[model samples]
Target: PEDSSRAASVVICMNTDRIRGAPMAEAEPTRTPQVDSRAILEMDRLHVSVDGATIVQDVSFSLRPGERLALVGESGSGKTVTALSIMRLFDAAGMETRGEIRFEGKNVLTMGMPAIRALRGARVGMIFQEPMTALNPLKTIGAQIAEVLVRHEGLGGEALRRRVRELLEQVRLPEPLRVMRAMPHQLSGGQRQRAMIAMAIACNPTLLIADEPTTALDAGLRKTIMDLLVDLQQRLGMSLLLITHDLPVVRRYADRVLVMREGRIVESGRTDEIFARPGDGYTRTLLEARQVDSMVDAVDESAEERLSCRDLGVTVGKRRWIGRDTLTEIIRGIDLSLHAGQTVGVVGESGSGKTTLALALLRLMDGARGEIRLDGMRVDGLPEKRFRRYRRDLQVVFQDPFGALSPRMNIAQIVGEGLDVHEPGLSRGETRERIRAALTEVGLDPSVMSRYPHEFSGGQRQRIAIARALILKPKVLILDEPTSALDAAVQLQVLRLLRDLQQSHGLTYLLITHDLAVVRALAHRVLVMLDGEVIESGSTGTLLEQPTHDYTRQLIDSALMT
Candidate 1:
């Protein structure tokens, strides 16, 4: 192979010799060549429309054999449409597609349903963005992978079972047999993603289209997945169409990039060239978003007294489960404190009891066995009516801004809701003034007050959420993965705004997130949670830089990659 640039080349061979060994290795015969070093997916003047509105206009690109091409764009930017058009999977209702999609030198649009179906999984496979939605819930992970083999290769019985296990093992999943029998609900987020990857690669398709494959994964898991994708592409000799908006992923993984904005290709070039000297303004903006680094650096503002919890115990259900022998305790003996103007970041993976802790602090959960003190006032065991009075002091910014905000309400109404709930009969002028000020503080225009939630972009909507939280003038703000759903640029803006707000308003924050970059940038103190327990907790600088626990070290390493 003369072209080091053409294929996924590795420096050293991996240790695949120890897998089941002996008879298993002997039984597995070498498969036929799958990849062809020729142009696999080519689009020329591709135009698509929905409900008489043009979405993708005159888009042209080509995916060469063994080449990794990335389609970069924001939401509603026709990236998904282009990929769907190639697969002939676009909806017939109010949607129209035209122009040539030459896959293996054949026009896919002209092909019949049966012909396209034949080529779908056998010739090309797709790794969807959200594995949770892409994978079936009731089917076992193994059966899902085996479906591809059965459909395309016609493998059945023992041959199918062996191939399914081999595919799972190839993706580096643990206990392949067990995972095969387990439902999607039984696996973790990362494990589900690996299973999805295994299914995509089961048929050894010539072309693989991965759309935002790492969106739901953590930084460490993301790196592992990308490495796995590269390895699989190399071993299978498949052409990869990588679609994403993440610039760091582009810098580390993609060879060529096609930048899209408003359904148009704004710029197309090599990854290094695009990053170094972005010709388009949109490309530059995308790069700038990715480069939004740490903006929180000042003297320690952690107050000595603000809020505290002691001997905090919490359980969701009344009756003990696990055959009446084991009761699942979400939080047990959890002792924590937050000083005035201090930022405490709680880090953990999904279903690790991070959100449970947050909800308990707000007294949302009933029958919670705990002692929570706010400003020297005990509120944990207080009645709901009395706790509502103390709620003014505590504000929460949820993870999903879209879901948090009311679609029917305008910006001013959303921000003013807190004030209306707490202090009724307030003058409309006063309410407007407060709303405008909060919006201004979050880097949004006051003029957008009349706009509805749907009218604003995602970044703007998130700012509105922050403004809503800030409007309450709460002494302590609980940020539940506030920036997880936002893009890099929007996230930076929000973080910087929060820092400024905290300093100016004298606000203390309890930031709950899984992103270590955010923790390093904004957190003064760190709390690492795993399986409903604090594995490690200390000063942010010391804990992140010199993490003692293995989990903490892993989180730090994941953040530093690329």
Candidate 2:
């Protein structure tokens, strides 16, 4: 590497691509004779760094031919770094890697430029997490795939077109011709993912690198795409290196597992053995991630919610504040507006005022000075007695359902707690009926009303919490990391339920979380907070893809598992 500030232990392995000046294109690789290699891909004592910061350290593993190996960890656990190192792509991002990465008896770290470039697409194909970004916006799907074939296999004209159609068909997409002509955004998420797979496997690479392939898809589509990948891997006789944080996916598909933490390999074993009896503490915690089922009642679509605020600031002290007093301004200068059925996501690191802002808006915290209006009615600074009525119009669903739901209270009492305060004169029979209706509205069995919160799973308890909020027919819900405590599949189920409820009931949402995926899934607008201040705010797509603030960019990049 030429840069003095950033160095890579690259071992000078490269054969110049025409693009050294242009972006390097994967060259037509000289296919070696098929041999029974011990390992399709192998790495030893690998280390990756960027700007003098260590990300991946001493990671070693081997992926056997036709076997599925899962590299498991949360974001920033160095999963992507290791995967990218295998393809030798760190140079593009100004990152450095020092270690031996061998592919089929050849150390890629020692291979020449052309040799490494050939390995990128011709020998080891990569499927990135998001296809919308991976696929060209201006190019047709057919043209993109053809470009790959032309660069590697040198196909032309009718054959190139024919191969593109064949790839679409191979991925089991309906009407190859239609998909071939369609632009990326024109296709659904699942269809776009399938196209990505077609492009990755075009040259029949010996090893396939799938980096968070299904993170963007819904619960059902995740399974379908994985199933397709497994089938293709088997039929094509290719090894798969799956990089993901999903424990359930690893259990369902991966044969071997490599657990990473803080850039180091903490554990490695067969998938069944690791799940059945994990050795590492972090590995066990990941295995113990909650799993639960959910249900909801059908409601007629009716939308009506409006929330806005200005000059809002919440101080951590008594209700009164003075310049000399010991008061701290935790949240300041917040301006927000939400229309009916709108979802605004509040994202930041812990203690960054996300939760404090929610409390200020809900009027749950004291020392909050701001102009707050709900549905065009000023509610700020109202007396306790007067504001109690507005409590029925606003509600909150917390991050941990187990912590929020009262274990001592039965489901009926929990859901009907508000009804008792607001409609104290209602008959017992009427109260019970309303509670039942509320539980049914949130997809919970009304029959379970007699059970306590501890009797339910994580997902069920969250639904109970939602039912508790819905019992009052609130116009707005403050969802504080509502789905973070659930498993990946359960997370999607809850997100889908939230979207449906918002559309049908015309309810508004203020979502607070650190997950960008969740933000993209639910939020129409996003506010990036830092040090109790709003540093950047914009529409979901623009801000996430092209952030203007340095901290906001760092936040997104960290979440991106770089």
Candidate 3:
């Protein structure tokens, strides 16, 4: 068998209708399969390096007409870089690249700018990770989408307008005419994504590469986007290269799975086979991480609250950076309470004022107004002089560990900064002991106390942030999107850790998040906000399961079906 010169993998016959993973259960045996006679794309033993650091080595994968392949891995694992290489999207001058990319059996590495340019946006189309960044800010959605058609196919005038509107309707954006007139900034995150997808598929390219296309979307939006992609793929018979960290999408949609780590394809197999028993350690870890939800501690509603916010409001003078003339009310008047040993979940879409509310609670935002009670003492509107005394009673855990921690400071100093601030008379040795204990509580090795934030993974860096907060032994802990950045399994782990810590220390928590699944898993009571307004408030079971408000129902429906 080894001596035979056949390719090891399945031979993808290039037929537009003969897509990979076609279901045969409902088909008649007499019906012949159709194959598109084209090789959409291929990567051969490619090597890539970033800033002298090798990222991908000898990575090879292929796509035929009407095939679907998923490239999956953790952040910084090179899944994106590989896709960039395929598109010839990355600049070739500074970064080093070696290997062959065969498109229609022609080596792309040997091609000139003219030949490569002819392929991009015409023969090859790409959907970016962040639609907010992908769509143009200055152009209306219709104009922006039309540009792709104009540049690639020379469609103009009334034809282009009609095509653009049709494209919007295909992506299921309501009121296509009205949405077309709006700019990217005016559209919701999901709407902008739909527009971007419309632009990508405008040219009807043979290949479509999607890079983390649903990261910013809620559950409902994610589902809609995924379904749209699947429907488009089937209808157009386009070969799809999906790059994402989302496991559920991969299992439900992908035909083949390509596992990447440190820029190499460590495992490639049928989707079900790879998911059932991953061949590589990295693949197994990635799968395991996705399978689990956020780590969480069971909330004890019976426990008392250590801290709470009563009728909180924060206002700040608006800057002229975005053409705003007057002051902006970020957090509207709101009343919320946190019981000791209980977790309260705050949820909303992007820019829904959730983070603003958290910042207000910490009094971090300038010109704050509200009543923040820590251990029964009013903290809001307290003078800086008086606020310093209560700082130890409340602490916050940030979403990004890399930005939150000081680059120059070691873990010991980062964790002990709270102690040094509140208890200055303590000796250096005492601080070191406290830091070590804090690291242990967060399940990190005490040896890491000397390392900087860069010396950790996303999950580890987040744990360090938690450790820093826990070291303060603050009565109230504000967690802001703590697990959103993590993969599913790592998120599950972190959630469980927070719950355990909350129960063991009898800590009160105010969690702000956009993930409803997480809210369902972690929150006892749920608060829904939109446009600086608290539109829905009730227990998690009541609000999420049977919402009275239309807005709340839409939110819940979007999250569930997406």
Candidate 4:
């Protein structure tokens, strides 16, 4: 009976592996070809489906050793899905993968569970797009990287710790030992991303798959990460599979490009060839979107100030057990003025206090010391209850549409919540009319009002967020990284929409973003922020073309490179 029970357990395990489409035995040893083959990875007629819905269809590609390949597409375009499929990282029960994913002559689809596990970190490493979500918050950086080394390389004790420090150093992280002890949240965005890269390459994988690796980073940091990737790839003699929507990145780094759209590869060719002479209309459109048109016209300096701030400063404190609260000032005393019918861009890298200034101007943050005037009315010193009257005229669109919009609420409820609070006297019919108008203005269909935020795409969700802000008919609208999360094409569309809206309604904008391209597209006047101070301020044309400050020059140069 005991023997039968053991046999039954073995059979169940085998069945589970088969259900996952994983091989029951270890992968066979590679058989050397007659001639030296250059292909390190190949995908032939690959298709992936999740819960009966196709996410990737008939994708085929190959990566030669030490070559860089870019997979370009918009959101929900199967770029990430295809990459994940190659890694076999999907849920086995819900995901169905077909066709071949050959890695060094071994078919990953038919590799045994142990073989796949062995290949993942040691031979094929993946750096996910968002480091914050990918890194385990509970673990220190050392522990995270150590686990990879211990599992794949069998390094332990002092040897494991030394390897962790070396990995951190390889990624160019400062104070490797201190960084090893620090938590993910304690590190900056760029630092966290470097840590992620360190973990991905802990075992010195032969192939690295970086998905939107520089998406959340600043322009300077973006260039740094890109350089690091190229450096590491060349140093390790590894092939790179880069999945991103940044066209400039594709041009600069990728040797070849595959343009995917709606789960299918629309075009594939050499990076230079495709860019120089795109075969598909969609590819051409994407390229055209990269050429930003100046959405801002001549600024009327004589116009009245719609929003003005003087000596604005914001500070916060961290409580400690043994001493007084540790105070940290985010924004220093800074003055800002936005003229009516104008867009004033406040650009900076991460932690440069652009968002802090916006929050202070909106009176959303506590411990803000400043004098704020909106249309010549003193609103900063007013109490919360008294400030209610000015709320309708002052609104904001946040950075992350996914985070900004309430998941539980439908589109109508989310957009109409501001109206319910600010204009309670309006009837239900009037509220519906206003919501419809707002949705239409943002280029979203009013029929989607009953749908939840998750049902919509990233671009659509952003439009919904814009509608929520615009429904209030605010004179001064604060846009904080409004189009940063969107793809290049969607970003251009949103910029165009904002321009049209501003022209029609004479809306004053306080645009806060790290994207200089966005500033060039929509902002009339630009203010470059560094360490909470306005380092440079001028018209977008002059500031971007011939930046006077050293820091401003660096920012512009980095942006142009990307």
Ranking by TM-score: 4, 1, 3, 2
The candidate scoring highest on TM-score is 4
Query: Distance from true position, residue 348, model 1, in Å?
Result: 4.2
Report clash pairs, candidate 4: none
Model 1, range 73-132, lDDT digits (tens) per residue? 776677877987887765646888888999999999899876776666457777765465
The estimated TM-scores of all candidates read 0.72, 0.51, 0.67, 0.80
Candidate 3 Cα misplacement greater than 4 A, ranges: 1-37, 46-58, 65-68, 74-81, 84-210, 224-240, 251-255, 261-304, 314-331, 366-368, 401-437, 445-456, 541-550
Assess candidate 3 and give its lDDT.
Answer: 0.73
Tens digits of per-residue lDDT for model 3, 1-562: 1111111100111222232222212221111123754566879899988678787899988887777889987766777778877756665445889999998888887888777766663567677755654555678988877766665557789977877787787666777997898887655555676777777656566778887767655665566677767766766677889998778778777888998877778899888899898878888787665443434455566566566676666565555777865565766778887776777888877657787788877877775676777777777767888899787778899755555788799888888888888889989898888889989988899998878885566678889999988887888888887876566656777888887887788788788887887777777788888877788898877888798888888887666543
**Candidate 4 residue lDDT tens string, 485-531:** 67898888899999999999999999988888889899999999998
- What's the true lDDT of residue 344 in model 2? 86
Q: Candidate 1: what lDDT?
A: 0.75
- Lowest lDDT block of 10, candidate 2: 4-13
Worst 10 residues of 3 by lDDT: 3-12
Task: Return whichever of 2 and 4 wins on lDDT.
Answer: 4
Candidate 4 C-alpha RMSD relative to the actual structure: 8.6
Cα RMSD of predicted structure 1: 8.2
Say which prediction, candidate 1 or candidate 2, comes out ahead on lDDT. 1
lDDT of each: 0.75, 0.74, 0.73, 0.79
